[model samples]
Target chain A: MISPREILETINMISNENLDIRTVTLGISLRDCVHPDIEIASRQVYEKITRIACDLVKTGEEIERDFGIPIINKRIAVTPISIIGESSRGDMAQIALAMDRAAAELGVNFIGGYGALVHKGYTEGDRRLILSIPEVLARTKHVCASVNIATTKAGINMDAVAQMGFIIKQTAELTAESSSIGCAKLVVFANAPEDNPFMAGAFHGIGEPECVINVGVSGPGVVHSALKKLSPEADFSQVAELIKKTAFKITRMGQLVANEASRRLGIPFGVVDLSLAPTPVIGDSVAHILEQMGLEKCGTHGTTAALALLNDAVKKGGIMASSHVGGLSGAFIPVSEDAGMIDAVRCGALSLDKLEAMTCVCSVGLDMIPVPGDTSEHTISAIIADEAAIGVTNNKTTAVRIIPVQGKKAGDPVEFGGLLGGGVVMPVSNYSSSIFAQRGGRIPAPIHSLRN
Target chain B: MRAVITVIGTDKIGIIAGVSTILAEAGVNILDITQTTMQELFTMIMLVDISKAVVSFEHLSGRLSAKGDEMGLKIKIQHEDIFKSMHEI
Candidate 1:
């Protein structure tokens, strides 16, 4: 029989490697709270969310204290307000206000689903929600917004995508005086998974149970450690096996923790996202994973292949261990969160070009990347457009969380601390994509699209 | 009777061609086949109809087993309906 300590050690081995439950998202469906009286509806929405999510922070804290594993963010995702309030003419901003207030009172860091799912066409509610994002994010401190404009089965919603380009530009312009911070909280997605525990793109699907606890487990450091053990003479096949085994062990631990947490909390267990989430720590970097795979550094030759292997292995191991595995359960190469990645940018070993190439196989795109302070709004829109294109073409979800550090140039660091790590602003190629971005038309869905 | 054959083992060359060849030789018509290669592990699922086959289910299983041995594959054959009922839940 296994001792308690042994079991604990096995489940918590990577805790010291900066491993944590990245987010514990409580998904609340608000479709039933709709009422003709907007005020009554808003009140009902607020009460429902508050009542259901009241235990979220407390439970997360308890789990953190008892298990000694940090639950970094306690978040809530409601049904897409647009669909929930389809009949309401001008209640989106009011509802968003109620959500913001509830999040503050409940002490959750972020609340998602302030946007729409307009992959095929836009409804009046969706358009209003899209228009209200600038105000919503500007006025609310904890709200995050996302729009799904494409899916493998439904093709791309070019009209919605085109409108988003304008909306994002407006959002950035309206909030530019405040550091254009609102754009950082918004994501545009394609093929978005329903059970992702991370933000700013988590929402309760209509099909989910009344409530569930989804855990996103991450440990770039653990994979890095395993790679450090490999001899220089090892071939690509050996390296692939090592990553597979390491991912298998890590995902097993996630399974155990998810089960234990669900049993303790009395909530139905959700998927365990086996993403190789990175941090600002030195050893806990996806770039280090590439370096370990015999690349001189990340952004070198064979980087994409190495990342593809690691990503595939992680999915395979996680799927075998849990039937409920979901989310972006692959390697994350967020720039500012990983020290090695930041260093690579500083040393010119990584560039936006290479980062874009890497995002094709990564779970997230252009994440936590810093651009020059003077980067134009059109340029920013262009960056998002490019990432969105990749996601649509590949039938994967991608997002950009870029921070335009004010008054910072290449090699200047902005420190957000904690999970949002410090990183230097990298130079954006001076060459302009503004003309293409300014055209402001939707790139039509691919011909093979079939998603509903 | 319809049957499903799941082939799982270390992947080598000609696993699909070998298995399909055996089924074809037995006068079995395959309805569907899906194979995925994950590193060294090769997994395949084949749905076939055996009611019109020239041989019995046991004989087909035996012949497939013999072919698997020749090809170093691990093969498991079951009635398609049985497999679906067991898994569809």
Candidate 2:
């Protein structure tokens, strides 16, 4: 018999601590759906996703009701729409419409993989996909897009990097009335993982199966609650130890949920992403977990060291509990989506530069960060380049989802509502990187590439 | 299949009787049950085998919860595999 204490702890974690399955993304491959005719290809794409993911949301709800744990988002990630339209170079926007329509018909929250992988260089299809991103994202409600512009082995595609900066700026302009919200759904990556279950970066990699189920676990509140019991004088090592124990338990629940979702949906179980993803809900912020570690604020001087410890310990603890742990398996600090982060921005304790530094130690880079509307596209490219350099040189996945809010300035409030939350815009550097961005070529693979 | 049924709220008359009646009607056999008071609130944890229940898991859960509401308690029935997986190696 299970102890009442254990049962109560699980209930407390869910009811008060906000432990949950962040997403159970269904990854479906669309390679076989390609056709020379654009309408036929779109129809095939829609039919395949609708047919396969028809029960995804229902199954997720059933699991949620049966297990008594919240499953937040049921989403789908298909092969990058570029590949599906490569044969005809058809309007990728039409395919985006099809994906969004399918997501609506199936009642999934978001459909990802309206993207391309152009780390080294672009195939014609990748080019078409990249060019269509701004319009596609603006035209579709439920589609999330990503462009991987760099890799450790192949080096950074500076051309793609420059192009995406302009694309992001265009996306913001196209949806400026809505606080440039479309930019929130776009991600630019360096070494982006293929099996990531979270958006706006998740995509079905070419290596994945026909379809699979991957679950992302979130419990910053749980970690915060566990740490709340410790004495104020607990040492850094003791803090790390407690986080590991708590993380082990959190990942266990994630794996259980993942397997159950897989069994019910009849999709092969992919990895359980051992990530402590945060929500805008109070008591659920990853920043609050850092603050629970004794920091007054999340992005202060000691914040980098504290985040490094948190990120490493979470992976160490989670790897043991899960059979195959992948995805961005560490703390996510998406501004505007986390209450503590939003508060930190309001109090002027967190800034853009500090966030860039924090991303070096964390799983993802510069996520959901808002900047002045007048910020230049060249500067955005420079920001993506710096993050790409960090990811490529360190052999880790990093991404930038920076939003340059149109017609807004530093310290001005921007409201996006819902899970996106809202926060004031942060200042960007005055300097321009136009010339540097215009000098487009590949950043060759680093010295570490000679490893074999 | 097995499940963990938890009843939590203020202690009141017939709380146990109410939960037991629902289980009895649904053919759910209680494997273990324990009750305690924490912070002046009553908490009861019951481990039950629902494989022989006449109702589907969802229907049984809804019926138990509706009954719990009438009895002024918050009841949740979760599949037991969640606990076993999280607690046991």
Candidate 3:
């Protein structure tokens, strides 16, 4: 029998500490759904997603009821639409609507992979998908779009970066009535994970199985609670130790839930994404964990070192608990979705520059940040370029999901509501980068990428 | 299959009797139980075997939870695997 203490601890963590499975994402490959005729291809995409992910939400709920774990989201990640729509010569938005319909019919919240990958350069399909993102995202509620413009081997596609800047501004303009919410559904990535269960960046990779189940587990509150028990004199190593032990327990729960979900759905279990994803709820912020590590605030001087330690220890502890660990398996520092981060930003303790520095050690870069309405397209591109450079140079995944909320400036708030929680717009540098962005070409792959 | 049921609230008479009654009616045999008091709050942990349970796990859980609500207690029934997997490995 499991010890009574352990049982009580698990219950307390769930009820009080917000320990829950963040997502049970079913990865469905849509490669076979390609057709030259746009309407037929769209139908095929819709049929396949609905057929494969029909039981996802129901099964997730059933597991939640039995295990008493709150599975927050049941989502679907399809093959990057660029590849699937390559041969089709029709409106890409039609296919995006198909995905939206499938998500609605299956009762899933988010259906990702309305994406284009132009790491080196764009093909006709990639160009079409990328160009259609602004309209596609504004029209579809559940569909998400990601564009991967850089990789270690391929370097950065400055052309795509330049294009995405315009697309993001257009997306914000199109969805301006709803707090410029379209930008929240779009992510630009360098080395985006194919098996990521979290969105708006998850996509079923080409190399993945035809159908599989991936789980992302998060518990910032659990980690925070664990650290509270540590003595003030606890060294950095002790802080690391406590974080590892807490993360191990969290990931073990993730592994169990992943295996159970896979078994129930009759899909191959892919991986457990060991990430400390936070919510807007109090006590569940990654920033609070940093503050608990002795920083007066999250974005202060020691913030990067604290985040680095937290990220490394989480990965180290989680790796051993699961059979497979993949995706963006570290702490996520999304500004809007975290209460502590929002406070940090609101109080001026956190800034875009410091956030960028912190992302070097964390999972993703510049996530869920809302900038001024008048922030230029060229500036957004320049920001994306910087993040891409970091990813390419360091050989780690980095992404930008910045929302340029129309009519909202710094000190004003944009209320996205739900899991896409509201946040105040943070000020961006007023410098112009139009000339730098207009220099269009690929930044050549690094020397380290030539190791083959 | 086994599950862990935890009952937490202010100390009250019939807390054990009420919880056990639901399990008995559902044909869930209680394997072990431990109760403790911390300050003014009471906590009871029960290990139960539901292999021969007449009701579904969800059904049994809902019934116990509804009973808890009536008695002003917080009751949670979770599969035992969650605790074992987290604590053991």
Candidate 4:
């Protein structure tokens, strides 16, 4: 029999701490769903996704009940639509509609992969997909989109980056009535992972098998609570060690769920993403974890070093527990989705610049940020370019999911509701970057690409 | 096939008897039980073999939960592997 103490600890983590399996994402390949006629292609795409993911939610619920662990989301990701849409002659929005309809029918919360990959350059299919993203996102409720504009081997695609800046602006405007909610559903990436279980950045890479089950586990509250019991005089090394130990236990839960889900679904188990993803709920904030590390507040001077230690320790401990660790497997500091981060921003302890610097050491980049509605598209593009450069040079995954809420100014609040949460708009730099963004050519690949 | 059911609430008479009755009805055999009173709170951990349970896992959990609510307690039944995987190598 399991020890009584261990049973109580696990139960306490669930009932008190906000520990949960963030998502059980099923990746389905749509490479075989292509047809010359857009209508036929769309139908095949919808049918394939629906058939593959039909039991996803039910199975997730069953496991959640039996195991007594909350599985927050049952999601589906597919092969990037740009590849499958190459042979189709219909508008890209039609495919988005099909994906949306399939998601609704299958009862999944979000269906990712309505996206394009153009790290080096754009194919005709990639171009059409990128161009249709704004309208597609505005039209579909459950469909998520992502565009990869940079890779370590392929430099930055400035043209695509520039295009995305405008696309994000348009997406925001199109969904302005809903607090520019469309931008929240779209992600722009550098070195985007093909098997990421989290969104709005997940998409089944072409190299993945026909279908796979990937799990993303999150427990920032649990980590924070553990840290609270430690002595304040504990050094950074001690802090890192404690965090690593906590992360090992968290990742173990993910691996267990991934194996169970894979066995029950008869699909290959992909990877367990050990990300300390935070929610707006109190005690669940990654920023609070940083604060527990002796910082007066998040976004202060020592914040970056603290986050770096946290992110590194989390990965080190997680890798030892899981056979395969992938995806954005580190700390996520999305402004709106974390209560500590929101408070930090509201109290002037956190800023967009500080958040950008912190992203250099964490998982996702500049996530769930809301700037003034009047912020120029070129500025947003420049922000994406800056973040892309960081990822490209460092050879890591980074993404931007900023919402420029229309009719809102800095310090004003935009209520997106639900898990997206509400946040006060953070001010952006007033400086103009229109000239640099107007340069439409690719930034050449780094010298390291000459490895061959 | 085995689960750990935990009951936490204020100390009360007949709490163990009531829980044991529910498990017997579902054909779940109690393997071990540990009970303690810390301050005014009563915490009980029962390891039960549910391999021969007559009802579904969900149904058994629901019945136990309803019984717990009636007794002003919080009862949770979770698979044992959840603890083993977390606390054990």
Model 1: how large is the Cα RMSD against the reference?
16.3
lDDT of 4 by residue, A271-330 (tens): 999899998999889999999998889999999999999999999999998989898999
- Score each candidate by Cα lDDT: 0.74, 0.91, 0.93, 0.92
Task: Judge the docking of candidate 4 as incorrect, acceptable, medium or high.
Answer: high
Q: Please report the candidate that would top DockQ against the real structure.
A: 4
**DockQ winner between candidates 3 and 4:** 4
Error of 3 at A347 (Å): 1.1
Quote fnat for model 3.
0.86
Off by over 4 Å in 3: none
Give residue A339's lDDT in candidate 2 (0 to 100).
94
Stretches off by above 4 angstroms in model 4 are: B38-40
lDDT of 2 by residue, A252-352 (tens): 99999898889988999989898989888999999998888889998888999989999999999899999999888899989999999999999999999
Q: Candidate 4: lDDT of A339? A: 94
Candidate 1 lDDT tens digits, A36-139: 67787788889999998887788777656433456778888888888766666455778888898899999998998787887777888888788888788778
Candidate 3, which CAPRI tier?
Answer: high
What DockQ would you assign to candidate 3?
0.82
Residue A302 of model 3 has an lDDT of 96
Q: Per lDDT, what order, best first? A: 3, 4, 2, 1
- Candidate 3 local lDDT, A173-232, one digit each (tens): 999999999999999999998899999999999899999999999999999999999999
Please compute DockQ, using alpha carbons, for every candidate against the native two-chain complex.
0.01, 0.82, 0.82, 0.84
Q: Relative to the unseen true structure, what is the C-alpha lDDT of residue A138 in candidate 3, on a scale of 0 to 100?
A: 89
